[model samples]
Target: MKIFRMKNCLLGSAFLLLLLLQFSCKSTYELGRKRAHGISDNRLYNQIVDSSLSYKSLWVKRFSAHYESNGKSQNVKGSIKILKDSIIMVQINAPTGILEVARIYITPDSVKIIDRLKKEYLTSDFFFLSEKLNMNVDFYTLQSILTNSIFQLRDLYERQRPFIRNFKGKAIGDKYVFLSDKAAKVERKLRKDKYSRLYRFNYQRFEIDPSLMKITDVIVREFGEEREMVLKYRDFVKLEEQKFPSELVFKVKDSIQSLSCKLKYNKLEIDEDLKFPFKVSNKFKRIYPD
Candidate 1:
């Protein structure tokens, strides 16, 4: 009962990636120091923007990942489906029989988790989740993480407007670095969410691979927090000439808790109409945050 009260439920809520931590601070910061041809920030930004993975939907046929926490390690496999800006569904499978360990459904507004191991379910909104995690989070932020794209702090995810362009960009040695308004040493109005009570757009930064022109890393820390959510994307594979990450890893921590994981996609498809199936069994009891 206590196990299901907190950790596992967060795992079902896209905390699945907190599964592994084969991460290094040196690798994330010290890369791409080689000099590339001189280009304007506008030209460089345009190239990065135009090169984004264009898609309406994405399907993860299967994925294998390793996650570690509290000095314990484990390997897991799962599947995910995304309806651009609409919905995301994830299923974590048991080691054998490949049975579902958990099923999660996420919409722009709310989150639903059905935990098989505990035979319990949780229904909550991002507002509650934000308050629980003590961070500024929304559906778009997770979507961007899963898809390996760039977004702005003020407007959230980038749509047709390319909110990232407003970020100052430059080739720092070998990698292109982008800073949020605050990171750029520029003053920008930050908004407060009525629900979470946390102000939006803390210190944010991005690192891009100059060769691929895709954002390879993202880091976000709230106004007063010490630990930050650091995400790194690598091992990109091209499908139809569009680049997508084959390996994704990240670590996020606040004051009392932390999570880290390494994920590798086995199969991927783009722009496919997909269905997300979710149903709680009668035997499954509904639970709430402690």
Candidate 2:
């Protein structure tokens, strides 16, 4: 009788263990299935794209800037004007008066910077800027940055812009993370159907705010290097039924040095015909670099 009781007890224990295992597997499977389905639905992406700003022009009355590089910090005030999709003008001035310290003018094909203190001016293109900054960039990316909109990290406008749906987005916590690379399985499927290529989908990650449907952060991964460039946006304010981030931060770090810039927007006006004045003084030497 004792032996029979022992065998029965062991059998009951094993049965309970098997049941627990099955339940765990089923729960995990269900969760994964739901997640996959949600990503497939992709309503979040659509919402995000739709939330991007549509304006003919923008004029920023005042903005504060704080920059930190290698344990040093500085603060200044500035203003920006944008002729939407065409030109951007930025002016950095002294903290007290209207004495301009530096001015930058950017367009679809050109970039010009005037350094008041150094008494020089620089005329360059996006290619040189990319070489110095060590990232793939173009005019569209810069425009997106200033306007707090979503954009891809490559300079493939003439060839083909990236299709955001090529990659997948996953909801984590309160935000959605969209990466710019397709999975092996998805790649195979697309290629099998002769789908258009993803236009050089590099390793990039964009974090979007679910409530505001704006991109809060963008991370770019450099090939053959373990470094990342991060651009973060926050402190959004709504105007005319649209949201814009009033505060934005950019950071880049490597083994040797680190850099950070924080910008605060004080005022914004949209659809205003703005002036972009850029005059190169004769005293300032010209530097057109390749």
Residue clash pairs of candidate 1 = 18-260, 19-67, 19-68, 20-67, 20-260, 20-261, 32-174, 33-174
lDDT of 1 by residue, 18-114 (tens): 2221111212222354555566767876787687778888787777777766556677777788888998887877776278888778888987888
- Kindly report which residue stretches of model 2 are placed more than 4 angstroms away from their true locations once superposed: 1-42, 155-161, 182-202, 288-290
> lDDT score of model 2?
0.59
Model 2: ten consecutive residues of lowest lDDT: 18-27
In order of appearance, the predictions have TM-scores of 0.78, 0.73
Compute the lDDT of residue 118 as modeled in candidate 2.
Answer: 66
Candidate 2, residues 1-290, lDDT tens digits: the string is 11111122221221111100000011111111222224542676778878988789877777666666667666666677778668877777766738887776777887677777667777777565454444566767767666667677554222454556445678876667776654444346446974334333335678776666677788775433445578776656666567666666677666666666666565577888777889988998775554
